[model samples]
Target: MYVPKNFQEPDRDTLFQFVRDNSFALLVTTGDDGIPVATHLPIELLPGPDGKFQLVGHLAKANPQWKLLGRDTPALAVFSGAHSYISSSWYDHVNVPTWNYLSVHVTGRTNLLTADETLAFLRQQVDKYEVHSKHPVSVESMTEDYVRKEMRGIVAFTMEIDSMQGAAKLSQNRDDKNYQNIIAELRQKDDTDANEIATEMAARRVDNGQ
Candidate 1:
């Protein structure tokens, strides 16, 4: 989250889109014993009545992390996008190796959703992903008794986003000569993540009118 001026992504829309693309995020909260607990889950962002973004996700009922959720409790959702290792050799000039990546950190207070609200969220979440399937299965297609029994095994909560910080460290600090070289080398690699970081760097260049 410690983003430098050159790497910081200030656009709210961009950050929200990044979250949507990388919906499976890390949720972090501290316990009473001061130990941090994290859960990896698919969290969706929705607009609230006050025009603010809220993150919604569910955890297994046995997961103790949900116990940390409260109106006053602080929570962090971390969305990690494409990332790749940048070799110093790829740079035209002499430099140390580094990482090029995109990430967004959201901080807010979390509250547990009501049972009815949780069910609605579940149905919506199911539809969101199932739409891509050839044979999509929906919550409404299931028996009411079965759905209710399944819902009882999870806890759903929402975090009203108070702040979001995005970092797009795609070698923006490098000069054009080195930047172009980085992308070229990344594309030559067989790694998908490397190719994605290269694509992002090229897109950023276009955005900056370079």
Candidate 2:
């Protein structure tokens, strides 16, 4: 996450919102062999000590990646938001093509939770994602015995984020006219991802006081 001053997003609220909106993230760690491993999981971000952040997610007990966390190993959780291809045609002929995106990298020490802690973590995730739904579900509705049994199938852990870096490269370096053209072109596309990126670009313009 080598974010230039212009592209860096240091706002805490902005980074948290990005994580919430794009909750599916890549959890990366180094295996026992010292090889990097990545697992794609839907994560729930929670407040940590000293106004920091923590990431909670579960992986199958069968997933060997979880074994790397017992000793407070370092890990990274990467949350990627909307991104799309930007055509050079949207800019002047001299301009080259590029991709526009928003991403946050959370680096932290990983800790595997105990069985009881893991159950609570899973409950929190269900509450977070389901509370706003039209038909909200509750862990209480499920038999306590059954819930305990189910928790055995997965390993839950929390990453207490030691540092976080966010980058939002949304065509800010482009001239106003070129940026507007890029937004317009993106809006014309049927892909929702392109349209979402365009909206973010427009919002970034306002945030930068451009």
Candidate 3:
């Protein structure tokens, strides 16, 4: 992530919130052939007391990507938030089309979790995603035997995040007038993704006291 000073997201809380809001992430690791393999999975982001980040997720045991973890291999988890294409028309003809989005890249050491630990991880993920649902589901409701059997089909792992890099490119470099125009154009669109980017840009402006 090549984040310029203006676009750099240095707030730890903000980055964590972004990860939680966009839990579905791309997990990448180098395979034995030295090729990069990626898996899309829903992950749980846990923040440590020391300001480090931890990620937990599971992939199908049959997926060869799981074999890349452990040892000296490094993993990257990429979380992406609302993104949309910005038209040049929104920029007073001075700008070219570009993407407005938010993303966080987490690099860390990967470790496979023990069976017992994996079970706990699955339970926590269930609770996190379902806690706010209108019809919440509990892992405990399932029989212990069934849960164990289900866990066997997947490989659970944890990443002790060594570093996090965040980039929020929302026309921050544009003049206030141009930025306002872009926001107005985005907000008028029917697409939810465009609206989301507009909202983030608005919130970021407010945060910067602009």
Candidate 4:
């Protein structure tokens, strides 16, 4: 993630919130052959017993991704949120079209979870996702035998994030006139991505004491 200084998102609170909201992220690792392998996974963010934040996610047992990359290897988790195209016509000055987006990159070491941890991870994920559900389910919803059988079908892993890099390319580099123009143009559209960028831009304006 090559974030320009002008586009770098420095708000630590916003960065973690973005990860939680867009928890379905891409996990990337280099294979033994040095080819990059990637998996699209939904991760649950949790505080470990040791007090460090941990990423909890599972892959299919037959996938072999964990066997190849889950142990003692560097990994990257990419959380991509909203993005949209900014037309040059929306700028006050002559400029080419560009994309505005928000994303977070996490680099860490991955470790396969033990059987006990896998079960615990599943319960936590269900609890987290079903917090608002009327008919919330839990690990106790299934019989012990059934839960064990199901656990055999998946592989769970945890990544303790060592570093996080973030970016939000939201036209902060533009002049006031151009910035307002971009926001107005975005707000005029029905596209969610554009609308999201517009909202962020408006918040940024307030942050800048505009």
Candidate 5:
């Protein structure tokens, strides 16, 4: 989250879009003994009337991590997007190797939702992910009794994110010659991460009038 000025992404909408595209994130918190715990889960972002973002997600009932969701415990959600290694060989000038990546960190207080709210939360998640399905399923498709029984096994919570920071280090600090060279080399790789970072770098060039 310590983003240098040139790498800091200040656009709120762009940051939120990154979260939506990469919905799965690392939810971290500290326990009573001060041991840090992290849980990986998919999340939904809800914009509040007060212009705050609420991160919504559910954890299995058996997961003790959910106990950290209280006003006393601070929650940090981290969403990581494309990342790739930058080989010094790709740069036109002599330079050390580095990595480029995009990520966002959100810190806020969290609270568990009521049972009714949890059910609604699950339905909303289904709607969001079922778009690609030819036969989309709905919570209404299942009996209320069965849904209630299944809901007992999970804990839903929402974090009203008070702070959010985004970093997009896609060779923006490099000169165009070296930047374009890195992107060209990266695009030659078959790896997804490499290709994605390359695409972002190319877009940055267009934004810079290169």
Candidate 6:
């Protein structure tokens, strides 16, 4: 979350889109013992009562991390996008190897959701993920009693977003020649992350009208 000025992404729309694209995020909170606990889950971005954005997700009730919620302290949600290793050899000038990536961090106060609210969230979640399936299943397809029984095993909560920050470290600091070379090198790799980074870098260049 320590974003350099040059790498900082201040656009709210861009950050929100990133969160939606990379909905599976890391949720972090500090317990009463002052130790940090984390959970990896699919978090949805929604507007809260205050008309500001918030994060919604559920955790297994047995997970101790859920106990850390609804506290005075805030929780952090980290949405990570594509990343790749950038070798120094890709640059003409002497430079250390680094990573090129995109990520967004959101922090906020969280509160437990009512059972009805949680049910609604679950239904929406199911629909969103099943949209691409050939025979998409939905919570509505299941009996209400069955769904309610399953909900008993988990805790749902919403974090009203207080702040959001993003970092886009796509070799923007490098010279034009080095930047182009890095993208080319990344694209040559068969790795998914590498190809994604290359595409993001190329897209950013076009966005900046470079």
* Ranked candidates, highest lDDT first: 6, 1, 5, 3, 4, 2
- Summarize candidate 1's per-residue lDDT along 1-210 as a digit string, tens digits: 689999999999999999999999999999999899999999999876578789999999999888899748779999999899999988766789999999999999998888888888988899999999999998889965688899888999999888999999998888898899999999999999999999989988988899
In the predicted model 3, the residue pairs found to clash are none
Candidate scoring better on TM-score of 1 and 6: 6
Q: How far off is residue 101 in model 1, in Å?
A: 0.4
Q: Which 10 consecutive residues of model 6 have the lowest summed lDDT?
A: 45-54
Q: How big is the RMSD of model 5?
A: 1.4
lDDT against the true structure, each candidate: 0.91, 0.86, 0.87, 0.87, 0.89, 0.93
Which candidate tops lDDT? 6
- Greater-TM-score candidate between 2 and 3: 3
Candidate 4 local lDDT, 1-210, one digit each (tens): 799999887777787888999999998888888898889999877888899787889999887677765667779999999999999988666779999999999889988889888888888788888889999888878755688789999989888888888998998888888898899999999999999999999998998898
Candidates 1 and 4: which is better by lDDT? 1
Native-structure RMSD, model 3: 1.8
Give the winner by TM-score: 6
Model 2 has an lDDT value of 0.86
- List the lowest-lDDT window of 10 residues for candidate 2: 45-54
Off by over 4 Å in 4: none
Q: State how far residue 141 of model 1 sits from its true place (Å).
A: 1.2
What lDDT tens digits, residue by residue, belong to model 5 across residues 1-210?
A: 689999999899998899999999999999889899899999889865477678999999899998888766679999999999999998766789999999999988998999998888888898889878999987887866788899989999999878889999988888888888898899999999999999999987898788
| TM-score ranking from best candidate downward | 6, 1, 5, 4, 3, 2
Give stretches of model 6 more than 4 Å off.
none
Writing each residue's lDDT as its tens digit, candidate 6 over 1-210 gives: 799998999999999999999999999999888888898999999877788788999999999899889988999999999999999999898879999899999999999999999999999899999999999988878877889999999999999889999999988888788999999999999999999999989999988888
Model 2 deviation from the true structure expressed as Cα RMSD, one decimal place: 1.8
**TM values, all candidates:** 0.97, 0.92, 0.93, 0.94, 0.95, 0.97
